[model samples]
Target chain A: MSSITSAKANVLVVGSGGVGTMAAFALEKGGKASVTAVLRSNFAAVQQSGFDIKSLDHGDIQAWRPSAIRNSVPNTATDATAQPYDFIVVTTKNIADIAPSVAEIIAPAVSPGHTAIALVQNGLNIERPLIAAFPSNPIISGVSFIGATEEKPGTIRHDDHDVLLVGAFANPNIAPQASAAAAKIFSDMYGSCPGIDVIYEPDVRFTRWRKLLYNASFNSVATILRMDTSRMRISEHVIDDLIRPVMLEIRATAAAAGVELPMELVDRMITVDTFEAFFKPSMCQDIEKGNYIEFENIVGEPLREAERLGVHTPALKVIYGLLKGLQWQRMEAKGLVKIPLVSEPGMKYGSKPRVVT
Target chain B: MSSITSAKANVLVVGSGGVGTMAAFALEKGGKASVTAVLRSNFAAVQQSGFDIKSLDHGDIQAWRPSAIRNSVPNTATDATAQPYDFIVVTTKNIADIAPSVAEIIAPAVSPGHTAIALVQNGLNIERPLIAAFPSNPIISGVSFIGATEEKPGTIRHDDHDVLLVGAFANPNIAPQASAAAAKIFSDMYGSCPGIDVIYEPDVRFTRWRKLLYNASFNSVATILRMDTSRMRISEHVIDDLIRPVMLEIRATAAAAGVELPMELVDRMITVDTFEAFFKPSMCQDIEKGNYIEFENIVGEPLREAERLGVHTPALKVIYGLLKGLQWQRMEAKGLVKIPLVSEPGMKYGSKPRVVT
Candidate 1:
């Protein structure tokens, strides 16, 4: 390794969606970190010509490239020259029921006891898998409040909030000091970037639950009803009948799980002025594009938690069921599911089977 | 009135959709009733060409008009020669929130105690409105299990099932004998048709709840997910997760309300072979066509009943909430509800006014 490489921390981002791309940009701006971003569908386009980003927080940036761009995550076992990443910052969607999970995708670059794995994604209970995979490694849980979308391949438009909450998960297997140090180091570097606020929160579980109040309610409703924020908030009874009840249910679930979220947050969340009238939530946008929504993470996981806690969450459960059917529609379209409209002989069923019935 | 009209029972079928037209056809076919149909949007089309029906039970028919057709229900106050009908068979959708309720639409034709009001429609507690309107009149509750759809204006495709459960809703204000006699007369005339089987069910509430086990589950899920029956039953988990849970909720609600629906009926309803792979339920069709769904009657009323009976129905409640939001989309599109994307100065909101916020 070079002298400069020894001085600077190495950071690798596993997903190159709008969030991951922006996270890479912010980490690169810190200058104390060498950033490598793994891109998939937009790899060729970005490699030929980097991201064209128009941001409300950070001014327009044309063709900005990270220190290194990769088509796939680097494997230390497969590649002789692969560097041990200090912080493997993953920003992919926390969608369940996918073929190679996030843990499998980012396993290669992990340097055992050295590299601290940081998850910059939405949803609850997302940190457990990484903690299970790398018991010795520090797991930094991140919650980003950013409004960003890759309008097209390598074309990003970030027009709203850019705050992030990062916390080191206190795994009993690892030293608390080690986890805290790792989180602080990563948070310090990320926080150094302009137009971004990265808070080093010791516990982020409550924060994740706090954010879910809106995500679980508004995002799911918008997708199910096929409306944007403006149209979603169109009627008082829609709020009184549909949205508010869901938010209340989510709050009760959180409270049942020992997190006492305030009632005023519901009002603040419902009236959150960050988004414009036409702004669609990421989940809603994912559904509109016929992509598999992050149903399990955003809605299903919370409902599971509520179930575990013995909380009555009818609103949440119903939304979860509806989303499950909706996500099936996408899976069916992608030929990932076998719809048994007619019976087939010796056909497998469930997630793998080609015949549904 | 003609001599034949005096000899034969005079029946008026309001709202000439598939059900209404079919009811008129069946009544007229019995040769004991002279059927007059009130046509709405398809009045001109039906008046000119009549209904071209392709039925599985009865042979295909073309240009089959009723004995008489009118644009509107005859108002006795305005029309000097209006006949006091024996049975006013109302077959329109049982949607709650509308400008003119079914009672209002059929009020002018009701000859008070002389006319027996027959609701040849779907849903629970539909007889109450008619009972309230004409306290002394006999209210006949009719439930039909038929596969029929108006493909266009007046062209109907009736493929399977021609069974009607006719029962007298015993209102305390009306004599029991009067209610029973009225029900028997209507059932006899309708059942005399070669392909139809009409049973005089003394109490139809239990039958309605049994029917709701299908409508509340499959029809609601189908509309919310925008899938046909075949695709909806494509997966076992989908049935387990969505359809069955809703059926269970409906059953629990029914049982709580003192009507025990059989559990085997859930399986029968789920695997009902009457529908083709492409067959969409009426509610699904209504949603696809942007018409107001029968949310209040089909799903909402049951949920309300469940709430009143103190039955915990998370699945039903969530589906109800989702449908509420979905129905709002239709209401908003039709300019029934004002969407307040932006705050307007002193604008009236809710069902009326143009400002949403």
Candidate 2:
């Protein structure tokens, strides 16, 4: 067992969305490190009013003090905070595009040995880019189950119980330390947490592809078709004609990549016990909000990968084209607005990038 | 040439939607005889303010003195000058369920040749039941392009210039006297009317199937997916994934049914020429008005037909299921009222039975 060293960690929470706020609350509640939450103007308001957590177990956690800065990626650790971040949590959509020039700002503090980063966003390949950017430090990839929403800056509503899964992208050996630290930090936030899961699965590549297969079939299908999972299950017109083959193609692609995905991955999609039917899917939400979509990351990249792997993704290709066409059509229809359809191209927001994990 | 022997034919335009109003205007503008339009409510107001007709070519032809009645269907065509109808144009959805009841109400003047019934609605397989019920005379299958809206019973807005295409479901020749008479009446309706296109195309089945293909792709795809046609055309997501496969499957089904559709049907969809981004699709309009959809007639039947003909329609089947799921999910999420996920278990809409051609 690694000895418990008396170390002070510096943490920064970016992109004050539901996940971002939850990470901040968890970090400050851990009481092991100093945490600063950076947010955009939209979320900065929530932080200003104070972070509020309406936990299922705790009822509500309120008035948590944390620094909320606007969307600016700082140049140096010392500038955004007194030190560099021991860990930075980014929990936003397609941050690479929206804040390409906005990564420098953070809660200024650093003790590199005590530092690690966790990314808590949906989609397959969110970690490699960050890992590539920060080579020496521990950059953790996290998958979250808890559903949360930030009512305002600093104010967040925890509506459901969600567990966090953490893993190192390239190193299997680091999983134990990362998991221990992550578990301790998260448990202190609210006792009786479901506990954290850390896996050093032989191939992270497969895991990524597996998750992406689900997204490609469920998310893009739902988004492009503008229906929920349950809808796909029930409507004969859609089920037999639209969804099954796409799922089949995705399954084939996974097999081609030598990933023995648990059959349940596809099975569970149809037979899931509970589903949020009307809940606008993440992609649907993007379309509705007219934000720049992470088309390449979520769809294009995977498809290109499939091609390289010599797999036929005919169905996926069709869906991808439809989405791009619709995205373009929407942009053209919007006429003069500088909207991001495929990538968040040249979005000029008035605030800084929010730091979220 | 068939002699125009049906002099001053008495025509009743039943139902208050766009089709009903346009049918009446076509009859009146032709000045071939007496015409009466029966609207449920909106037309009542339009009539009170004096009927407004805005022709596509004639511009705004306001305050035309034509016969108008305000009330629901099944009402008498008996207002002194308005005896039963030489031709009763029943323009209502769920016609199988509604037609039998409507027929009882209008039986007061059901004559043989002088009173041929015409149906102007969307979808395939619906006409058979109506034809089965009223088999005494020719039940001309008419597809209209005259886009009109009776904002009130008294007002008709000629939004777009379109002609009615009339044909028998399976008959190559029946000596279409009524169809010829119908054309003469429509020719006088303002200017630029294509007159009535009475096609006894060698493959009548193909004609109907072709139309079904368009509706299947356009209305259901655009509506359930919440996109307009123009956007659907150019969307890469739509082009590759959604549209192409669906179109191919639809064509396959059409071919299975002996319908020879030109490849241009799809090419036309992609390169709609100057018409590219300016068209308003019905599905988009349906979404805007918050109306329950006619998913079955538009998409459901063709898929079913494709299966009967031993064709593989994977795309259509999936789309079918997704639509049902979305329908139920949307209902479940919207209000306390639950409409059910299963659509009455096998489309009980057109239950009136089929008339042999």
TM-score of each prediction: 0.92, 0.73
A53-154 in candidate 1: lDDT tens per residue? 998878899999998999999997678767888889988887877767888898888877788889888888887888888878888889888878888999
Error of 1 at B319 (Å): 1.7
Q: What DockQ would candidate 2 receive versus the native complex?
A: 0.17
DockQ (CA atoms), all models: 0.33, 0.17
Alpha-carbon deviation at B147 in model 2, angstroms: 3.4
Q: Report fnat, model 1.
A: 0.30
How many clashes show up per model?
5, 91
Mark the 10 consecutive residues where model 1 chain A has the least summed lDDT: A348-357
Clashing pairs in 1: A338-A354, A340-A356, A348-A353, B340-B356, B340-B357
| lDDT by residue (tens digit), candidate 2, A204-313 | 45656666656676677767656655545444445445555666676777787677766656544443313333344567667766765556566776677688889877
Chain B TM-score for candidate 1? 0.92
lDDT of 2 by residue, B27-107 (tens): 666666466666656654665665677767456766664565645443334545445566667675432221245455445
